[model samples]
Target: MQDKTNNQESSLTRRDFIKTAAIGAGAAAIVSMSLTEGQSQTQPAEAPKTQPSATPLKLEDVLKKAREKLYPRCRVCPECDGRACSGEVPGMGGIGSGKSFHNNYDSLAKIQLKMKTFHDVKKPDTSITLWGHKLAVPILSAATGGVTYNMGLKGKMTDEEYIDALLGGCIKAGTIGMAADGIGDPLDIYEIRLKAVAKYNGKAIATIKPKTQEEIIKRIRMIEKAGGLAFAVDIDSAGRAARALPGQTVEPKTMKQLKELAQCTKLPFIIKGIMTVEEAEMAVECGAAGIVVSNHGGRVLDHTPGSADVLAPIADKVKGKIVIFVDGGIRYGADVLKMLALGADAVLVGRPLLRGAVGGGQDGVALLINKMKNELVDSMVLTGTADVKKVKRDILIV
Candidate 1:
């Protein structure tokens, strides 16, 4: 039998069932809805509002608004795992097959939390200090941009507006955000994001693509002038060199080039795409102050392991040698605890935070972070974990 809600449309697609599966069996009532071009861009469609409870219902409102704002480009699905929009690169899904993206979600989900209630662990400390800035939570916004083509929000939202929402929201939440470097962006577009970073002087991170050494150094100088607390080079973007527009080039960096980039800046230099123990070791050898275990959210690769799948081994090899951070499929505070127990100094959240920004602006972003902060505190209390900075490995049944 056909579903009545999808009046004029056919039965639900694989993506729709995937969404239901991720949320729960009951989420079938909230099947994905397709919007016309006119409605997709202009009107805000009503989505299912989450049931009110002790947990804040604000995120559902934010997701509903974001779904309207980012329709077609992103369904803002019940689950943000790559399943619903797998293999969509220009838009929001991962690269070919999206196996890498799926890995991120599966790897984290496979680890079971060992809950303990027989302890006096009240008021867990969810704070951590990164480069002298004390954060209310161990979360930061990963560098993300390309709002126009990537998010289909060109006319609806400008690049500056998006960056402001991200950086400003992170600051409001007592954490930090990273401004991205779009492969096809013009010099002016890049400068505008830097200005946003400068707006939060010494509180934000600026990320550059894996362009040439000269080009990388040039942007580092600009980041320094912007008073950025740190700068990162997403070496994983090297895979998209062919997609780069003329005059904007990307390439893999050699150890010599990496060292030069690290020494050229007074700010902390982070290498943002280390996925292996060998590469993690090389990042330390290159004098990087930090390394983000990522696969560009599985956007740049097809069959790579999830950051969660590889984080512990990499962390075991270089956890204290350099600050270790992980990103990819981190959607909740429980996931944050799992990553910490597996060995991560902190976690970087991408898509959900992006939804918060696109859907609810700065306040939306702050609300999302604050919600996760509360969840993190609760998770810590139940697991006998006392602090974000000192999470133990025994808290998980991996």
Candidate 2:
């Protein structure tokens, strides 16, 4: 809830935050040069360090578009940082109490990096392979839908157009995209998304609600026919029973059902919306290919800890065996680095990208991803991290 105050402290922009960090890094480099001035002649000469005012990233321009397109409708606040939009899940805010929303941001902020001045820091390798295809960054778009109902962007664009823009952006950026389905959505509307995913040649993923086995399987068959690379079911959607469609219901999967569902697909089976180590273990037992440490962007449950708060423990319980990804309060590239250090193969971003699609369409999404990639590299260089895959616990000041 301190986003306004914190964003003010961010000096009005994300660039300013990176600028300050860069300046501190420059200062550290200068001190290191001073101490090693007369070291062994075999050492390669290094450039002198002086603080350079970092320039604003080109991505900032997209926010200008977002401001015009969003705002009044979504606000597109100075910072996409969670506070302004908590407790409004059905319309872009977190679920009741907003505590879960605040926790994701708070826990990530509490994790400070142990930056080093002397070491072999290479260009950060931000690439990762998800479900067999390589991506430029270890990031994915969180499955989100209902621009009219959820984003309040009525009259701005239709649902089909919105899905196209988001998915197109991700694929163009050399990464995968996620297309979401809602229980209230008509079957035809859901199939429209399936066609879009197929157009991307199976690079896009499909997400289903936790509906009855027959309905869920029917949808899965459709997704596979569409050439989706993988599929997931947001179990958190089960809590929205009041919103269930007539003749349709959503419920949590029993272990038996989960195993059967996993068997239903040759593509990777991902179980999203998991928050407990026990549930995470259950996912493994059910033959899941991945598990997303999410609290449904804090939109499904109230009074729960943020995904970041529980991720470390869940990750400790199941790390290499399952592709672990996390998604709440992930507004920055530094947050991506933090999650990877804590134990995540990748991270997903939600609201900001929605704004990106709303404002600049595919271009905006690519710009946002490129910006996060740059910021991740910057943070890695400052911390002397050479590789993302081998990120160590020592990097955390803890």
Cα-based lDDT for every prediction: 0.83, 0.77
Model 2 misplacement above 4 A: 1-58
**Tens digit of per-residue lDDT, candidate 1, span 3-48:** 5755533466766644443344223232232222122111112112
Residue 79, candidate 1: Cα error in Å is 0.9
- What is the C-alpha RMSD, rounded to one decimal, of candidate 1? 7.9
In model 2, what lDDT does residue 343 have? 91
Top TM-score prediction, candidate number: 1
Error of 2 at 71 (Å): 3.3
Please give, for residues 183-214, the per-residue lDDT of candidate 2 as tens digits.
Answer: 78889889989988998887888999899999
TM-score of 1: 0.87
TM-scores for every predicted model: 0.87, 0.84
